[model samples]
Target chain A: MIELFNVSVQENKRLILNQVSLRINKGEFVYLIGKTGAGKTTLLRLIYLDLYPSQGNIIVENYSSATIKRRQIPYLRRKVGVVFQDFKLLPDRNVYENVAFALRVIGASRREIKSRVLSVLTQVGLNHKRYHLPHTLSGGEKQRVAIARALVNEPFILLADEPTGNLDPEASRDILELLEDINRSGTAVCMATHNYELIKLIPHRTILLDNGEIRREFSPAEVQQLKVIE
Target chain B: MSVFFLLKEGIVGLKRARLAAVITIVSICLSLSLFGSFTLVGYNLQDVFNRFYKKIRLEVFLDSSLGLDQLEKLKKKIHQNPEVEAVEYISSQAALQEFQKTFGQDLSSVLKSNPLPASFRVVLRPKYTAPERIEDLANRIRRLPGVQEVLYQKEIVRFLHKYLGLGIAILLIFAFLILVVITILIFNTIRLTIHSRMNIIEIMQLVGATNLFIKSPYIIEGMLQGLLGSLLAVGILALFVSFIRDVFYHGIQVPPHLYPFLLILGTLLGLLGSYISVNKYLKY
Candidate 1:
């Protein structure tokens, strides 16, 4: 569960998120849709405690974002998985190591980490590529590896920013389906994307933003209507 | 999470960047070797001079015009001073005989008569051997009746004292400079090794790796570098020391006690260099 109230983010005297209030409950799948410079990444960063909110409060699993100590940031991050747009895998490491990286950071036992990493790799249908290096994997496969890394810790919620922005349609569809399956398994996921087609395909709750303001909260039907019009 | 895993990671990292690690180790050893050599030389010089100072004695030549009674009284006055440890009166004939024994073959044929002066060989306590203290004692002896010039080679003592002080000062400066140079070189080497893995660092950070978790391997690597470098340096120094003792034993006199001290110094330098290098680069 994540909540943001009257949250505003600023960088270099420019407002990125202007007094935004948003909330997502546990086990819910939500889409954060916005154009470039619409404060989508900034919002995700706030929930992830990467950047402090300029004005307002954010609660991620009961920890206050505005007041959390810098040292506690890692602990908070351990509870929430973040899938970056770019698959930030260590080039020198294999897929299994990359996924196991998250578990290692949290002090997971080697045996537990191996089993968990293998299970997540299997879940993402990349079990065969476990030992393959990041450079050897395709964009889809790399993203899958990133997804596996994010989910390896079995975090309560997953925050993805433009998870499918760089993939082809088929790869994008695979990533979306993987996220949908993850969501169905009862982990809350708040994914930011401009991929309206994928949003239509999945038909999740959609939060729309324009110029730093939440323009509308659209039902699955309204989102379908918007897609049809587009 | 386990220290074993952290150490394994550190060792693996070192193995992966073998060239950099070797460079770091070599730099540390070179710096420490220079430092250790300077320290050993300075320490031994101090030791040799201290021994020489402890053995130095003052000679008070008695006036030939004085009577036996006056000589006895003067000797009693000199022996009563707390600074005088032992004083042995030598007659003029006895002094000449001792001189003949020392340079008998070379100068015995050239001399017409015994020219050595009658003197008291005065050995003072160790604490009174300092130039100022010896000078004070010499002045006291010079004022005694029936006593001629009091000789102690004041210039030699002064020169040795000043030279030893300067050596120590220069050794300290050299040690400081070597420490700075070694730290910077090791820091740069470790930084390069870490830079190659910046992506891994970022990913680790993203995955919620604590700062300690990220830094532990580098610290361990630094410690290992220090230990290995020190061991190598001590080994090299030991060889050099043995060679000097074997081939140039008469040229330079190093006291036996300095060997263990040099090894400890080398080990400390290695540990300090590694700690400094690792701490500098391990920070965000």
Candidate 2:
């Protein structure tokens, strides 16, 4: 579970998020919708403690942003998975190595790492492409590798910022569906996207942001209607 | 567990930064070798000084009128003293022979009769090996009957000690400066290597890698370079020492502890450099 208590984020003496408060319960699938500079990235960064709130507190699992030392940030991150828009995989390593890297950092044994990495890659349907490099893969395949890396640790929550931002529509849909399947299997997924078509195709609890404020929250049908108008 | 992964990554990082790593290793090696050579020189200089000091003696030339009985009495009196280690009686005939042996001609062949004086070559105890101490013993011996004059080479010892002390001081200062400069060079080299893969480090942190996990590879790379550089220096120095022994038939003895000390020094230097860089440039 994730909760933000009147969180305000300021960067360079400018307010980025103003008195923002939100909560997502366990095993929930949520969508964060915002334009280019609507503090979407800032909100995601707050969850992972990449950027701490200026005037409020966040609780990810049991850790608090206000009291968390720099040393505890890594432990906090291990409990949550993050997916970037660009599918930030280590370029030099292969798909398997890229996926295993996450597990390796947590002191996983080679045998444990091998089995878990293989299992996660299979879940993402990229077990067959385990040896392929990132540059050699299609947009969809790269996103799958990225997802496999995120899921390898079995995190309490998956935070994806523009997971399909760089992909074609078909690849984007595949990634979204993979995310949907993952959410169904009991891991909370928070996907931040600007794709209106995605909301219509598979509506979920959607939260919209404007000018660093959480403007409104819409149910699946209302968000679907908003997507239809788009 | 993660140790295998860390080691693999460390080796991989070294390969990735091979050019910079090799250059750093060479810098460390060259500086350390110079240090090792100076240490060896200092050790041998001490060795030579100790050997020469042990042989210091006061030479008491006897008067030409003194009888063999008086000379025997003087020799017995000198040998009885606690400070006297040994007293060798060189008769005037034996002194002439020694002179002929040194100059390759009999003194009797050049002059009507040998003018060389018979002397007692008296070696002193270890505590009296100093020039001033020998000078005190020389004055004592000069007052004895049948003794004409007392002589010992005191200036040579003083000159050698004073200059050798200054030389060692200068060497130590030079070594300190080189070590500091080498440490800085290694720190910069390691910083560049880490900067090259900073994104990867950031991603590792993102994926829950601890600070130790992120730092391990860089630290290991630095130590590996250090170890390799130290080995290369030792190999080169060993060959040079062997060459000296073979070509000139004069062995330059290296202190036994120096070889191992070099390895430890090199490794510590590498660790120090990495630590400094990590402190300046790396964070969780």
Residue B236 lDDT, candidate 1, scale 0-100? 81
Best by TM-score: 1
lDDT of 2 at A227: 42
Q: Which ten residues in a row have the lowest lDDT in candidate 2 chain A?
A: A221-230
lDDT of 1 by residue, A59-170 (tens): 9986897678777878888888999789888877899988987887778998999899899999999999999999998999999999999999888899999999899999
DockQ of 2: 0.64
lDDT of prediction 1: 0.81
- Interface RMSD (Å), every candidate: 1.6, 1.4
lDDT of model 1 at residue B182?
64
Q: Which candidate number has the best lDDT?
A: 2
Model 2 lDDT on a 0 to 1 scale: 0.85
Error of 2 at B152 (Å): 4.3
Inter-residue clash pairs, candidate 2? none
lDDT of each: 0.81, 0.85
| CA deviation > 4 Å runs, candidate 2 | A9-18, A33-38, A67-72, A109-112, A194-201, A208-230, B45-58, B62-93, B104-115, B118-159, B162-164, B275-282
Tell me the TM-score of chain B in each candidate.
0.77, 0.79
